[model samples]
Every structure is written in structure tokens, then in C-alpha cells.
Target: MTIAAYTLAAVLNVFILFIGVRFLLQPFAAAAGYGVPATQDRAYLEIKGVRDTTFGVVGLVLLIFAGAQAEAWYMLAVALAPIGDTFIVLRHGGSKAVAFGVHLATAAVVLISSALLFLA
Candidate 1:
């Protein structure tokens, strides 16, 4: 259980880092995958990139140095981002499928990861 929790946490962080990089390098594509289309203003996309990258780094740092309890708390807090994203997509004229399937699903996984870390 411990190993599984740590591994999942690490993998999730790495995946988040990848997503951040993708958002930075390919804003339009990333926004499309995020269940939204990017407008001419790319600043918000860059902000999202930075936010996700920072989150990924924080999660990794907590897991590697701060241990499971800290990582658990971080995960619990960070889960709110995706939960909010679920609504953002919905309110932004994005599809319910993407809003629920992607954002909500991610929130669920993050919460589960937090629970596992807490147990560990």
C-alpha cells in the first residue's frame, strides 16, 4: 500500500509536469484538450501552465522531502483546482462530457491519491 501510494503520487506529479509543459508549448492544443478553446489572449494559457507546473513541483517536493502526511495534505488542497475546473469548463460553454469526464474525473483521482497517501 505504501509503495503504491508513493508510486501513484509520483506518477501523478510527473503527468502534471508533462501537462504543464504541453500547455506552455502548445497552448491551443492544450486548451482544446482542457475542454476549452483558446482566444487571442494567450496570457491565461501561460498562467495555467505556470500554475500546473508549480503544483507539480510542489507535489513532488512534498512527496520526496516532506513525506506522506504533507503530501496528503497538499493533494487534498490541490484537488480543489480540478474540482473548480469542472465547473469552469461547464460555465464556459464547454461540453458536459469533457467537464465531467476530464475535470471531475481528475478530481476524483486526486482525492483518491490523497486518501491513499493519508493511509500510507
Candidate 2:
């Protein structure tokens, strides 16, 4: 249980880091993949990149230094970002399939990771 929890958390953090980098490097492509096609505003995409990168780093820092309980709390709180994303995608004329399949599924995985960390 402990191993699974830690591994999953680490993988999630790394994945988020990759996503952040993607957003920073290829904002338009990242936005399309995020279930919302971005317009002319470059700032928003850059902000999202920063936000995700920070989240990934923070999660890793918490897990490494603060331990499982702290990581669990962090995961629980951070899950809201994805949940909010689910709605954002839906409301912004994004595809329902992408909105639910990607963002909602991500939220569920984050929540499950939180629960696992809690149990660990």
C-alpha cells in the first residue's frame, strides 16, 4: 500500500510537470489537448503552465519532506483544480468527451491517490 501510494503520487507529479512544460512550450497545442482551444490570449496559457509546474513541485516537496499525511492533504486540496477544470472545459465549449474523459478522470485519480496516501 505504501509503495503503491508513493509511486502513484510521484508519477502524477511528474506527469503534471510534463504537462506544465508542454503548456509553456506549446501553448496552443496544450490548450487543445486540455479540451479547450485557446484564443489570442497567451497570458492565460502561460499562467496555467506556471500553476501546474508549481503544483507538481509542491506535491513532490511535500511528499519528500513532510511525509505521507502531508502529501495526502496536499493531494486532497489539489484535486479541486482538476474538478474545476472539468467544469471549465465543459463551460467553454469544449468537447464533453474530453471534458469528462480527461479532467473528470484526472480528478478521480487524484482523489483516489489522496485516499491511498491517507491509508498509507
Candidate 3:
């Protein structure tokens, strides 16, 4: 249980880190893949980077500093972010595949992490 919880947490942390970096380095690519493109605007790009990076680091901190129980709550709440991301992508001219594949999958992973943390 401990291994599962920690593994899930680590994977989420890394996944979020990748997202943040992608958003920063490939803003247009990331936005387009996210289902909404910012029209010649840098602000949204930076915002995306900030948002993803914050989520990643916060989740990491929760796991490392607060322990499994707090991380469980964090995962449960943070699941909503990806659920919303799913809708955002689906509603904003994003493909069904990306919406379900990426965002929904992420939500599921978060939920599973919550369950594992609970068990731990």
C-alpha cells in the first residue's frame, strides 16, 4: 500500500511537471492540444505554465511534507481540475480523443491515487 501510494504520487508529480514544461516551452502546441488556442497572446501561455507547474509542485509537497492522508485529500480535490480540463477541451473545439484520453485519464489516475493513499 505504501509503495502503491508513493508510486502514484510520484507519477502524478512527474506528469504535472511535464505538463508545466510543455506549456512553457510549447505554448501554442500545448494550447492547441488542450483544445483552446490563444490568439497571439503570451499571457495565456504563461498562465498555463504557472497553473500546471503550481499543481505539480503543490501535489509533490503534499505527498512529501504532509504525508499520505493529506495527499489523499489533495488528490481527491485535484481530480476536479482534470475533470474540468476534460470539459474545457471538449467544449472548446478540442477533439474527443484528447479530452477523454488525456484529461479524463488524468482524473482517473488522481482518483486511483486517492484510493491508494487511503489504503496506505
- lDDT (Cα atoms) of all candidates against the true structure: 0.92, 0.93, 0.88
Better of 2 and 3 by TM-score: 2
Clashing pairs in 2: none
Q: Cα-based RMSD of the predictions, in order? A: 0.7, 0.7, 1.4
Worst 10 residues of 3 by lDDT: 33-42
Query: Where in model 1 is the C-alpha error above 4 Å?
Result: none
Write model 3 residue lDDT over 1-120, tens digit each, in one string: 799899989899878878888999988887887767766787788787888899889989988899999999989998998999899888888888989998999899899999999899
Q: What is the lDDT of residue 37 in candidate 2?
A: 94
Which tens-of-lDDT digit does each residue in 1-120 have in candidate 1? 999999989998988888898889998899999998987668889889989999999999999999999999999999999999999999999989999999999899999999999999
> Best-fitting candidate, measured by lDDT?
2
lDDT for position 73 in model 2: 93
Candidate ranking (TM-score, best to worst): 2, 1, 3
The runs of at least 3 residues in candidate 2 whose Cα sits more than 4 Å from the true structure, single-residue gaps closed, are none
Per-residue C-alpha lDDT of model 2 across residues 28-77, encoded as one tens digit per residue: 99999999998769889989999999999999999999989999999999
TM-score, candidate number 3: 0.92
